[model samples]
Target: MSHSTLKASVIISIYQDVEALHAILYALSRQIEQRFEVIIAEDCECKAVREYLAQHTFPFAINHLTQEDKGFRKTKAVNRAVAAAKTEYLMFLDGDCLPHSQYVAEHLNQRENNRVCTGRRVHLGPTMSRWFRKKPSLIKLIENRLVYTLLGLPLVFDHTKNYEIGFRSTTLHKRQAKKYLTIVGCNWSVSRADMLKINGYNEDLPGVGGEDDDLGWRFNGKGIHEKSVKFVIPVYHLHHVERRADVSTNLQIIKQNTAQKRYYCKNGVDKYLSETHEKLKSNA
Candidate 1:
């Protein structure tokens, strides 16, 4: 399909980071390919985010799907967003992470059937995060990678060696081995049909943890392969306090799901899919 016709629903999971959220939305507005919708999967009903969305205007269609502020319900928020998505493809991102100008374009260009694309992000320090929050000139940093390298800021560059944008970088590679272990939820993409086949994310595993890996494992069990877009679709993750308290519990759930080779979760996107459809019908 041509770039113009290729539509994707970009789902961003957010939990109260207004500064970073604004920066991400601004960066997304400047994407090289402006053919995708933005869905804010808010874990809580953040008034600040609501105010910002109501005030600002964006080029693409933007929707907000928020739940109550109930601890860490990232999985539930994302599943709801997926149900409301109205595109052929879906791209997952965190609200704090600013995308490169070519991030969406690269992912859409490298999309394939029965495969999931996994990308990496650069963790910026507090200083750079603050600066970007003030200015939000993401295109400048992305276009001029050498400046960031020369400055040698205290940033953790995760698999960003292949940050160039070209036909060569857009080439998709298959991961025949270890496909399930490396799937990061923050920067990932999958077809809507494939996502439904596995029934979307597992809501049972909650509180900021291994729900992503469990989704990947289930996909792999269903004959789907993982594609690495590591350096090709790099984003800049803003610095923030970590919120992982149930790591062990989440990991144990993933381990059990993997050992059983379960391809579908009992509580997942199916729960909200019908409700979303009904609401849309009512609105119409």
Candidate 2:
């Protein structure tokens, strides 16, 4: 990679999880020799998260922003954040996620033409065994669905092991790219150009559930394959409070898009970004 390519940016979508945001920021600060800008898009209606990020000194300069008063869906906040990114490469990490030290370097190394790279997610809270012993209600499921149109899986009966089934590693390597059925927006990296092509994520996604799946569908349709980085770079998912369902219809949208390959094609996000340079200027 050239010096130009080394210029990358990290984009994170945040709502009200101050604790998770702090953890993510600390993990990112440990990277000793890299230079990249981190943009945090606070989608929540509150100012607490913004205040916290402002008070801290991160390893890299941090750009913090907020959207107009809107509900807590992640898509709007993230899009606003990406529009402000100042790098050739864009890495999306969830506020609740703890990336390994080599996370950014690993993704930068794996980047290739028309490709989106995603890594594995490991649960970081009490063992699955413990979860079953203290089975919590599906409060999270309901909140996620009703509040954000997102979905959370039922607690596994066994907690001794990681929730391996929830997040299986991708097997693809850097050189070869192939279409994928889905890509997790969190812990995934793609050129800012590629993202805008799919309209910077379906703002009309109806909820939080299928935004990633929708992006995967759009990429596959556009011939942009998904590559897994799990065998190499792994992320720890800090256990947190379950979310209430704000909406559940978006999952169905993803299912339909995946089945139909709704946005699969050759020309995609790259073209979109190029055309909308003025609109998404910051990310470029």
Candidate 3:
């Protein structure tokens, strides 16, 4: 199908965040009008999630895929789901996120001719429940989403700053520019053609470190500049406890790849997926 005619595909990578997964799925079910497919990539081979997915029916088709226990790292699992996405436009989010009602609709409405559109995210505290308090109109939700990070920080119901601190900046509210670089994987989308040009997510990324940064840098290198999706497409980040250890080692790989163009692209993801597929198949 042509890029314009293609449906949007949302890819979410989860590892043991069952509570967050529940909220994410629930929010997606209540979305206003939109055309999209949801892919839930469970990084670990857990029966609880598979069982939950099997029992709950979503408004849209949900494809649930599991990988053999790959520790807690997220890069590999994310790429696994991306490989299976059929839509030309792809959005990536963590399982702990609650998208506003217009999340999907606004994303579809703001396509800038193959440009990668990134949205503004609010950090919701664990104390605050993100469940359905009331049904929201599409326009109101979109307007809220457009609010920039710094401006929305004070008003966020959650009051937790963990996720917000990393993103709050007046610069984020502006349009695309030469040195612009802010890539939060949680609410980012790009055309399929653009992803293929960058060879998709780097599977060899040892850990979480530079995967998001690499994608943003590569996109900029290819002349597809990044732009903040105005606060109109606001999403609530489901609260969660801190994660152990830092995944910065992968950031080094990102730097290495940047200096040497098409490193992961040259290696290709087919072998990595084939190996992962065989590993999971053997476990089965």
Number of backbone collisions per candidate, in order?
0, 26, 10
lDDT of 1 at 115: 91
lDDT tens per residue, model 1, 11-96:
99998888888888888988999988999999999899899889999988888989998798888999999998888899999888
In model 3, residue pairs whose N, Cα or C atoms come closer than 3 Å (at least 3 residues apart or on different chains), thus clashing, are 142-232, 145-231, 145-232, 145-233, 145-234, 146-230, 146-231, 146-232, 146-233, 147-231
Q: Cα miss at 212, model 1 (Å)?
A: 1.0
- State each model's C-alpha RMSD to the native: 3.9, 9.4, 5.9
lDDT of 2 by residue, 173-209 (tens): 3332343325775689998877766656666565556
Task: Give candidate 2's TM-score.
Answer: 0.71
Q: What lDDT score is found at residue 135 in candidate 2? A: 33
Off by over 4 Å in 2: 1-6, 126-181, 244-247, 254-284
Q: Where does candidate 3 stray beyond 4 Å? A: 1-6, 129-158, 162-181, 244-246, 267-284
Q: In angstroms, how far off is 118's CA in candidate 2?
A: 1.3
Error of 1 at 13 (Å): 0.3
User: Model 2: how far is 117 from its true place, Å?
Assistant: 0.3
